[model samples]
Target: MDGYQVYRDAMTKDQWQGWWVTWPLSTRVRLGHVYDRKSDGVRRAGDLAARGIPFQREHGTPDGTFIYDSNESVDVAFKASGKTPAALSALTEADAGASVTFTRGRTAFVVFREYSQSGISDVRGLSHALVSAWWNKEWDDSLLAVTSVVAAAGATVLTAAEGGAVAELKVSASAGVGELGMADLALGASVVRHSALGAQWTGTDVTPFYQVIRLRKNWLGKIVAEYGPRPPGRGALPSALPPLLSEEIGDDPEAALEPGDRTEELPFHDPENE
Candidate 1:
């Protein structure tokens, strides 16, 4: 039997009510906002409030001690089921080969991008440019609020994984004219400058992580040259283990696993790789 299954079977109905068990990184990222450090589990409320995502919470115990109670957990598990070939098919599909279109002058440009890892970096830049254009009456104002929310949520998730608070993050933007050209845009295009968001961590290692939003614009004041989103491969949190599961799994739970156990595939389950 799987180690997680073994652990679950060992618990009583009441004991299970006081704990939230989860084992996937993608699911955890989707439901990051609901976790409470003091309660040590997911909140029982189904209301996402200001989070604004389509998913909701489910199966929560009265005491709010279960992580699987969240709707995102159920969704991830459904995707992981035999019904799908990939473990996180929906999430991976969304992240794989996604693109957005923005216009520069009379020409339309399609930019392929993803949202996992450093793909959030691309969002940061697009959000900056869209908001700037909206403020300057160059673009539709309808997308301003939506763009802000998505960018903020992405930043929160990325920083939360590193134990950083999003509220303390500092952001700055600047605009200037420059000559820029890329395969996606015409040669010698006049482009607007980039904006950057600086995120600082709250532990012994206080190095700040900077997310630069590049929104290149042509002479016609239209966006161009938005590409290249890569992950910040370094800077893993000092404690590789996620705080939510540390107590349930212990310092070294894998040693007790029997053969054929696949818990190693779960992120944060394998401390070395996390």
Candidate 2:
């Protein structure tokens, strides 16, 4: 699992592109990155709305702990299930149809159409620098997937596998002491496992991940969720961007359908579907 090997165990070659979203029991963060007690509740949301950016929203519990699923994919189990295309949603290698379903502890909230610039490619190939960081951080069990670097001149694009895996981060010399750069980050946030519905399913938190996913490149540049009204406490997540990137994600201004604010009966990958 250290060196370059077939990604067969991680994803389906037939469907090289696809993602899923799920919400797990809220994470308990000690030294948090995204969520903290000091931030405004509706600030991020309001900004997105004001900017006219499209996003998905859902209702939460009494404490305002509404769960949100960002850009997600399921390339592994789909192939194993031998399922064909139906209403495949989310982003895919072929088209823009989405699958809907629910799981234990959480329900399908909604899925908004993803918006991103074109010309971006998925990153392929492997490097020891990436693996060593993850393994040393005790994160060898997770899937390792790579994506193409978009717009970034000097960086590499690496995304986690469908089930999700933890990987290392690389930093540049110009990176500051506590900068978001790889070396400064050293060991970043934990990479938790996701359920079929995209919930954080891994029993405990895995090693900190080092990938950097830009907001311009992501569904949202910044994420704000109401875990529990009482400052649910911020938790760790994957890095903000991939390793060694050097540019911003361009705005494509492409017109697409809205994914909507709720999920449907997702075709859970099963033997029958296969």
Candidate 3:
């Protein structure tokens, strides 16, 4: 850890330094694109996004909705499962600041970074949001976000208690959930730079898989607000909650749903947290 250093992908114009020299105090920060998984760098900071999770991974930002490769110089291949011409057109042909959303079985995954029509970039603090838009293609070349909308019918998109983990949401092969979970989901969004009018970014990212765990209930409300709307109440949500980053404890979210010790509701039912 002695000689540890970090860098960023310079904006398309500035080339004074190869991310080696430090910039001024007010200089904006951009998350480094570490292409090496085993290189002891950032988490999920490379190419070939992790796969085999319950939910799907789609490309394109929450806006534009068109899938594109952000890997200007990486080896990752993030895949975009389903796409419609509408989603793609919104990104390529639509106006900047225009936004769309990608939903996985009623759950909101990633919102796209706002951009101008010319792709001039309004990436002030929108990095991870951009990753949510990756369609497992090569740098902005192979991937394209399709603007197709698949209905979520016949699939098992259920929710259990309020403000807690998604106890159960099973999808039968005979009854597919209309392209649900088809996009790679990401978390830990931080505005890397407010350097420009529209340019923002989130440097860190990880492909989260579904796991049965207790949710803090509204823990993510404020964060979600920064991007868009949130679940109306803690009782139930259209989309199941994402897995927690770690095992945590707090009042049982279900207690408020009913009117008892509610402690019976529990930190978690699966015995793992028992």
Clashes of each: 4, 31, 42
Per-residue alpha-carbon lDDT of candidate 2 for residues 219-265, written as tens digits (9 for 90 to 100): 22121121111121123332322322211122222111111111221
For model 2, state the Cα shift of residue 38 in Å: 28
Q: Candidate 1 — which pairs collide?
A: 19-65, 20-66, 20-67, 125-213
Q: Of models 1 and 2, which has the larger lDDT? A: 1
Instruction: Write down the lDDT of every candidate, Cα atoms only.
Output: 0.21, 0.21, 0.21
TM-score per candidate: 0.14, 0.16, 0.14
lDDT of 1 by residue, 91-167 (tens): 23212111111111111111111112111223333333333333344333211111111111111111111111111
Summing lDDT over every window of 10 consecutive residues in candidate 2, give the lowest-scoring window.
Answer: 29-38
10 residues in a row with least lDDT, candidate 1: 143-152
lDDT of 3 by residue, 153-241 (tens): 11111111111211111112221223333121112222211111112222222111111111122443433454354334323433323
Q: Which stretches of candidate 3 lie over 4 Å from their true place?
A: 1-9, 14-72, 77-274
Q: How far is candidate 2 from the true structure (C-alpha RMSD, Å)?
A: 24.8
